[model samples]
Target: MIDLALNFAFVAVGLAQVLALVRLVRGPHVGDRILALDTMVINAIGLIVLVGVKWGTQMYFESAMIFAMLGFVSTVALARFVLRGDIIE
Candidate 1:
């Protein structure tokens, strides 16, 4: 069933997010931490989309888009920090 599939997808995404968080926490390097955080955000978006499909809501989808944009900005900021040792000059 579609509901069962959605549940499975949610569970999988949740597991991935947890692993990504752990990686972020345990990262020995700043770049590793940033990559893990980015992965977590991407997985979160997937989870949101799945939830939206299950609940039949358009708002969730829109929010997921916003989250994606925020994730991109965060990644850029983090990368700049890593490269320049400061987010802002």
Candidate 2:
């Protein structure tokens, strides 16, 4: 039962990721695309955490944290670019 639940969760996350990717590609505006990309990264982190739990390893969680940090930085940079035409200063 636990295994089945994990499998289902994985499938759901995978489908969500595919939808997010589609949105990122088909978004009408740069901001919308960036938001979609952020969502994708978040979902990826969740997937990694789930997998880590299933495998009894902590490395996936650490990587997930790194991915989240990078995603946040990228999102801030992109938003700054869109708002001010430059990411640095």
Candidate 3:
């Protein structure tokens, strides 16, 4: 049923987040850690969207969009810093 699917999705996303956290903590290189952090942000956005779908609300969608944008911007900034040692010129 739909409820069962939602529960499964929640569990799956939770597990993914946990794995990402572990990678973030144990990554041997800066790039690996950054990749893990980005993955965590993506997982969080998925959770937020799932919640919105379950509750039949639109507010969570807005927040999810904001989070996605912030995640992307931060990832780009971090990558820039790693490449050039400065986020902005």
Give per-candidate clash totals: 0, 0, 0
- How do these models rank on lDDT, best leading? 3, 2, 1
Q: Native-vs-model 3 lDDT?
A: 0.96
Model 2: per-residue Cα lDDT at residue 46: 86
State the lDDT of candidate 1 residue by residue for 1-89, as single tens digits. 98888888988999999999999999989889999989999999998888788878898977899999999999999899879999989
Off by over 4 Å in 2: none
Q: Which stretches of candidate 3 lie over 4 Å from their true place?
A: none
Tens digit of lDDT per residue, candidate 2, span 1-89? Answer: 98999999999999999999999999989989999999999999989988997998987877999999999999999999999999997
Cα shift from native, residue 22, model 1 (Å): 1.0
Alpha-carbon RMSD to native, per candidate: 1.1, 0.8, 0.6
For model 1 the TM-score comes to 0.92
lDDT (CA) per prediction: 0.91, 0.93, 0.96
Output the better candidate (1/3) by lDDT: 3
Error at 73, model 3, angstroms: 0.4
How much is the lDDT of residue 18 in candidate 2? 99
Runs of candidate 1 exceeding 4 Å displacement:
none
